[model samples]
Target: MEKRRAALRLLPVLLGLALAPAAAPACEPALNGTRVESSRFVLSYQSTPIEVGKHFALDIAACSKPGAPEPESLKVDAQMPEHRHGMNYAAKVTKTGPQRWRAEGLLFHMPGRWELSFELRAGGTSDVMRNSLVVASAPVRFTEEEKRSILSHGPWPPKLVPDPSNRVSGNPEAIAFGERLFFEPRLSGTGSVLCATCHVPYRGFHDGRARGFGLEDVDRNTQSVVDARFNRWFGWDGANDSLWAQSIRPLLDPREMRSNATTVSRFIRNNPPFRTGYERAFGKKPPEDDEEVLVDVGKALAAFQETLVSGRTAFDDYRDALESNDVREMQKYPEDAKRGLKIFVGKGNCGLCHFGPRFTNGEFADTGIAFFARKGVVDPGRQGGIKKLRSSGLTLLGRFNDDPAQATALATLYVEAQHRNFGEFRVPTLRNVARTAPYMHDGSLATLRDVVRHYSELDEERLHGDGEKILKPLHLSEDEVSDLVAFLESLSAR
Candidate 1:
């Protein structure tokens, strides 16, 4: 039994030797049907039609020089010429007989002319042959449902409205003032950690930590501010209704800026640059109320942050290519990424919550991540968020809100926490997601693969009782997982 198993393992090799030619120009046997015959060997496969997106197989027979050692092995693969990409699925080759081989598991995903190539080897001799076939299928089409889903994620570089909640929202002078304040460290109680301390510019504005660090530590991971203006909710918990209000929480947090509203007010009021910038941006004088000044600072910070939108990504390029029906351009995108995208909107169901231009629906969900922050602490997530928003006087209900109609503030007024809100964190944007790691609200997962595996083999027991029922273990194959990760990484901004 052991000898038979060993022979089986070596079978492909032996078959290749039996068919390999002695010399590059050695005579090959004549054969018919979808074949390329050369002096060294004859390579042939079935002439059956290969419809795109459909799996098909054929016998790849080879005949070598008469005196050549029995062809040792045969290997077969296919590539789309225009796409310049190989088949997403690997082809399997097996020996059927002397100088005869069968290849299976061939699936051409795209419609285009394809090159079927073969490698034949015997002992130290080897030869290769190629045959071309135009494999095509029905023209590219998508259901109305799919088209809507795909289109919603784009219309890129969304129009910027610097600060809809504040009069300075789109003011250029305010933006400049805010830009200066963003890099100021004295604003923090530590007098060293700037806003850019956690939100580094080059690393896609992500601090790249499992949890953010400031004067002490931040419980959750630091989310990138790239394209942050699109987010209706702020923070992993959606604790703040506006970016301005969101900016204040970090400053007041003991672990973050560790500064009081009074201190922030004094610092800005005392600094000539800040005062001058503030006067030019918001008017001649800063607000007298300490708390009000602090709020204004947050607004300035928000103005600058809104400018940090992400640039175009590889996925964006591919999406544009698909839109224009530019086959040549589209082929440049990796097959792995395309397959991963199919899994994303299709089998993976990631598109449901991660939707829209920035790839988030701006909602919260309990996606099975643990809630514990410390030994006795548990994050109440969006539940806590709702409570905090309702009690905060700085909300849209307050005088700080510039929108008298309070259009964007309606969501806050209507929001109510239920059992489902517990453990729910905001859905983050997928743009530049590849640069922001480790992932998840808590950043417990270390890599994109780890996040994929977490969902692929989700722990049902850990999921919140009222969490999203749509989530389930994917049970994805290894290749599928790889493709999915590749696709997600493609979302990174250039």
Candidate 2:
């Protein structure tokens, strides 16, 4: 028991802790920036700013006094008390020479505060020293309800699932074929216009125009396809229920691809690679009827687009941390973002519609924005969408549906236009929203701040629904507005 007391280890209060230091042993070395001296051992280490979610190495030099016994071994490890968890991976310590050592495979998964400890043991005696590191991560703070609200937004980078309605949903062959067609301008009547011509990859898969320009200017803003698969309805007006049908609309719309079924089928049947890919994807030659051929092509395109989920963002990490009760990891999220998220979930009332993993309810809402397409033409919102859906032959309810039960048919079976839907548009997903800017259905909000401001100063009279009590002026201060915008930006993919 006396011998056990001699080997007793002491740890200094890390960061802001105020623990009493243990009486050090006789082997203390001169102190330096890279070196820490204790009574039983001297340890030195070198490292730069530690990065989160990545493995890193620490080169260490440790020694006992000249007359002292050599240590039997060294143990290295790390943990965060606030998070109530240790490193997801264990680091290996190796002796290089007389007193030189290296620790490898050290990683900080969630960033905030961490403690790295090194223990030197010899003949049942040990000495320990701890280094505090604040790994770089986006800092955030939250209230209890805010935590609950954020958690609802994810487990993110949502899983990709096959569309039951589209027979070629998850086929890699179909995805590759669709990818090729996406960049193929030849599918269009005008040779210069390709799907890629508007939905540029670098531009976050949005056309980057106020109104989409195809053969002629279209009335609505180009919605980005980053996580389109998760949506219940497609397009700004919620015109299409299935992504495949949604893809078909643009190909046939004169304002968009401006090509008929004959033109697209000709292109597919004439091109050897496309024809071969069509067969591989569909298990048959291209259909003779232009409409049948169009359906297959749309399915291929939807398969590829489903793979476009936004990468996990800072909000995802922070939300996860909060859910796991990791205080240290939660601290890494920016305070500004935290405040903004609070406003969004609470005072701002944005969550009424922008709720769920994709940050949208996948339903339509009237935000009271002006809907004028030009001088006198009105862009009738969901009402127009319903009329179009009912009148069109390209819907999930049509004979083109390969779905045996027509699983995507329920919404179609029940959907009907109402007077309240006159000015309502689909509630757009907010994932990667920072990159898809010029907000709202008309691209009327030039900036996200403008969108926030619009809600802050909304005109109740302009709202078409008399019973719609949700839209009211927020009267947010300038700082609150800034905070809200900051939170919204945290949703962008890193």
Candidate 3:
């Protein structure tokens, strides 16, 4: 039994020896930094400020005591003792000199106390030495121009205004009725799906799927309705001019709820709870006309969704501080994020399209994403959106519009589809962006890092001839990528 145990132990050492490289690259002499000592050896390590989530390297050196054998191998590692988790990636160690080594690809993914370990193996024995480190973010000081650019992003939670085209837009009863309908599965033809299936409240109002699924898969990602009240146009293709009209599309689509106006109105009229709620919202019994009841139900849904605005975030506090010239308050923001903000407003040119408190221009643009839906099918995007908008009777210019003068209908009337608008899509709001993953209209990019990389190495050749002139390859360094991701994460609510 003892012999078997001894042989099993030797297996690991033999495997490690077989896996090691024939030669390790040379490194400079000992790093003159933090030093630690063991009974048989003195160890020293040097590294930059270990900020959370940023990758860094370590230079290490060991001095053996007189008459003691040098270590045959070495390994370095770090872990959070309290959380019982290590780094997402392992460090690659290389012996640089007789007593020096370099460890690369070390990253601390979270802010907390970490226990760093260095293992020395010699004469069939190993010694593990450890040191504790406290990691926190250090913010940078901003220049006058940078401060001005940062301040423009927000004072946050912008004041809500009632929609001029929806008479019951701000009514509490209408909002309550809409809330009930939002979760009512019987509103669908199959009585199995509801708005919450795709716009799940817990998942940042997103379904977290690459494409939405109701009765079947839809060709686009499920967008959040968190701040729908502030939108100028609705959907990725901007097919609907009003939120209520957009709400009605899913009800009628065969791939979604698959219910006609007659079925929807009959369900609302026959159900006691829905009937009572509709009466409270519309100030009367459910209407006899199916089309009128359907539009009213849509208006009620829009009223409730308008109240779903996101809360204030860290970026808002920093922007507010910058506006008032409160240096101390501004300093609380991360240094890497400040660097990212500079890139965003200046070199990145992102603010040109994603400016304002909502962090969007509320317009459409072609960002070079592929428009192919299948082998021979194209999504058509804004071009098709314009065609649908012009043909639909549920627009701001239609009879259902509550505005007497039709003040908001001008855009709907004047919007002509141009050849350049072929693959254009609505620019999404950036508020609470970190929470909404599987990004883009098709949900192709899976992470904020991936989205940043897409722009960093943008394929300018892939862009259409009429694409936005401001877009170009950023050629960002890895550090800059990390900084930008940090800045974007700051936009999320705490």
Candidate 4:
């Protein structure tokens, strides 16, 4: 009887031990149909249950038959649930064992549930697996002083500055004439193309291409003509010192309008409607020669482009309420978006680069884009622009300029700042950013979530300029990133 009792006690202990491992949960079940034996593979990460306005990292691992042809190569991908977009995860692979692999990447500004997927391939075989996780909303926590500071500001106005040379700030006739010139396809070398071809009115006045496709392929992205008048300097490289000067570039570029002074002059003088319009605006008949007509064309185009200002968005509404101390209106915005706004201005420190009503300081920075095709061979960016400005006889200070005296001063200042402007590209406005995909000067990023994520977990090596130190890892929670993206989306003109 003693032996039987002892055996029973031992049996109970053994049973408990055997059950412990099973009860611990078997690695959350590699669900989404992940098959271990297959040479081909597909897998996804589990969704992260977090909020907007945060940052997160994803790491996935896989094991295969030791000698199974090394499973070709491992691939990982992720998709945002709410936005129906793919996140730009800077993926990297590490070998954990002979047949085991781990893939990792950072998700910067996306919020809400996201799906991660993995794929494995070996010997013409493949398999896939997927999983989802929820990203929650972030909490708002602003200080009293912060609230006071926000409340002290006022709403931004739609201000237009008068042109120093012509005193034509808001001339409706000039704008109307400029609008006609903008849409006229005859202006280009290929009559099929017009200013509207490169600066599409629907696409924020910018053609959605990497570099513009002109008479031939041009080597620069077409800058947005919207709100060009407000800009102190013009062009991606700031080659043109004024809006009118910038307008003349496309007309002369072989790949753009390809129309010389003579051709443009002939078109304007021969076209009765254009002649009448020009006469009304300039108080003179269209110039008999091409040089004079070309100048008028530049001026007209600038006038039309000046009207492309941004309209109010949800962020602006919230901003106005905050400025007026209207607590009720301010409270109407999503809590996550508000927190994101805080991150943008404070913790995230985005305001340092993106400031003022237009969300840009009109400055340039080297954001570390891979500009060089071959190692050690760099695209000299603004440096090239400086050289072009000096050599091109088209600048305001040059013989072709309508106001060479003032243009000369502007060009001189720009040249003096050449050292400070190397590799620098202008800061783009964030309005309607959601609609324009493939971010940055080079269109390197594919989506806004990717952009937010990039800024959230910026690679220090990529920011090859003076401000890299300021853009440290935000260490934001997943929710915080989402909130920041939400706030940015709210800035889009609806």
State the lDDT of candidate 1 residue by residue for 101-205, as single tens digits: 778898887656889888888778777788887864433344566656666677677776555688787778888998998899999887988889998998778
* Every candidate's lDDT: 0.82, 0.83, 0.88, 0.68
Q: Is candidate 1 or candidate 4 better by TM-score?
A: 1
User: What is the overall TM-score of model 4 with all chains considered together?
Assistant: 0.68
Clashes of each: 18, 10, 3, 46
Q: In candidate 1, residue 61 scores what lDDT?
A: 69
Model 3 alpha-carbon drift over 4 Å, by segment: 1-139
What is the lDDT, from 0 to 100, of the residue 199 in candidate 1?
89
Candidate 1: list runs displaced more than 4 Å. 1-144, 324-332
Q: State which candidate has the highest lDDT.
A: 3
TM-score for each model: 0.77, 0.71, 0.76, 0.68
Error of 2 at 342 (Å): 0.8
- For candidate 2, write residues 1-494 as lDDT tens digits: 87775545332324225654675765543223377656667788886457665788887777786566677788889999797788879898887776767789988876678988888888688888888877765444457887788789989876667888888888999999999989998889887688877788999998778888988988888998878888888888888888888887888888888887888899999999999999999999987798899889999999999888899899999889888989899878887788788888887878888998988889888888887888899988888999988888888888878788998789988999998888788999888999987888988888889998999988888888542687899998776787789888999999
* Ranking of all predicted structures according to TM-score, beginning with the best and ending with the worst: 1, 3, 2, 4
Candidate 3 lDDT: 0.88
Determine the C-alpha RMSD for candidate 4 after optimal superposition of all C-alphas.
Answer: 13.7
RMSD of each: 12.3, 17.0, 12.1, 13.7
Candidate 3, 136: how far from true, in Å? Answer: 9.1
